[model samples]
Target: MLIMKPRILNGMMICGTESEMRYCDIGELHKDFHLGTNTTIDFIMDQYDSGFLLELCRRTAQIVYKDIYQQLQQGNSAVLIEHLQYYLDREGGVFDIKTVQDEISVNVSKCPMLSHITSNGETLSPNIGDFLSDFYGSWGENTPFIISVDYTYPEESYCIYIRRYYAS
Candidate 1:
């Protein structure tokens, strides 16, 4: 059961699959295909726990960090922020960033995935916290500057994504 908003966003064709796939403008890879929030969460819950997801993300992020860590340092830490924005924006997520001294504060008013799922009547999985936190923690692995991340769960307000980096 794909739960889609009444409107579909802009997207190009995705080739090379068992069948041809179509992407919603606001999806990550295949995260938001024809499915809405509840369906996706149910799918995730069926497959893995929050800790498992976090460990998966941790190992994945570590690999990605190792491969691009040096390239990221070659220019600016803001590059990582830009990439983050790019992925989230792809799904029409709302986020704001404030930078002062060496810290980056990201306020996520509406997350494209979790928030979207919640909107569609899905209760968040218990493992969701581990998934979010460890994913952020993995970014600390290989940085030219020491980086610390703090994540706040979305409550009455929303979750916050904060990154503190030692500036070179």
Candidate 2:
């Protein structure tokens, strides 16, 4: 049997992979984080009082991005979780990706995402729901998070990828 690729998969281009790409849409995304109440960016700019929300969103994005980037570099699940937790525990109004790398370093663990979910949650099942739940619980109502990881092997047995999207 032969398999084809999807139009979009994990922020990558898969012309001839083992199978089609899969995408999972997480609703509401960062709405709980309170990016905006009812007004749009135009209104915020006109009012000249949207700095707070904007700052929060920017910081949130930076934190999430840096965390994931570092996690990937470490290549270890436990270290990734610990590193993220450390960042979350820190006190900083502005989010800076460079700062995260400076503070701590841990051994790289394969599949850092799984490690993150495992440490945050007591039990982790193969089900994606379990991972989502763990993420939601860890980030809390104020923290916004998004992730996208692609693993493909056209010549291998199969391809596996995970993606996370964040919005406020």
After superposing candidate 2 on the true structure, give the runs of residues whose Cα lies further than 4 Å from its correct spot: 1-39, 64-66, 69-168
Candidate 1 residue pairs in clash (backbone atoms < 3 Å): 3-36, 26-91, 50-127
Question: Positional deviation of 122 in candidate 1, in angstroms?
Answer: 1.4
Best by TM-score: 1
| C-alpha TM-score for every candidate | 0.59, 0.19
- In angstroms, the error of model 1 at 163 is 4.5
lDDT of each: 0.52, 0.32
Error of 2 at 59 (Å): 2.9
Candidate 1 lDDT by residue in tens digits, 8-122: 3344432221211122233245554423433443456678655566566667666655433544445355545655665566667788878777666666666777765566565
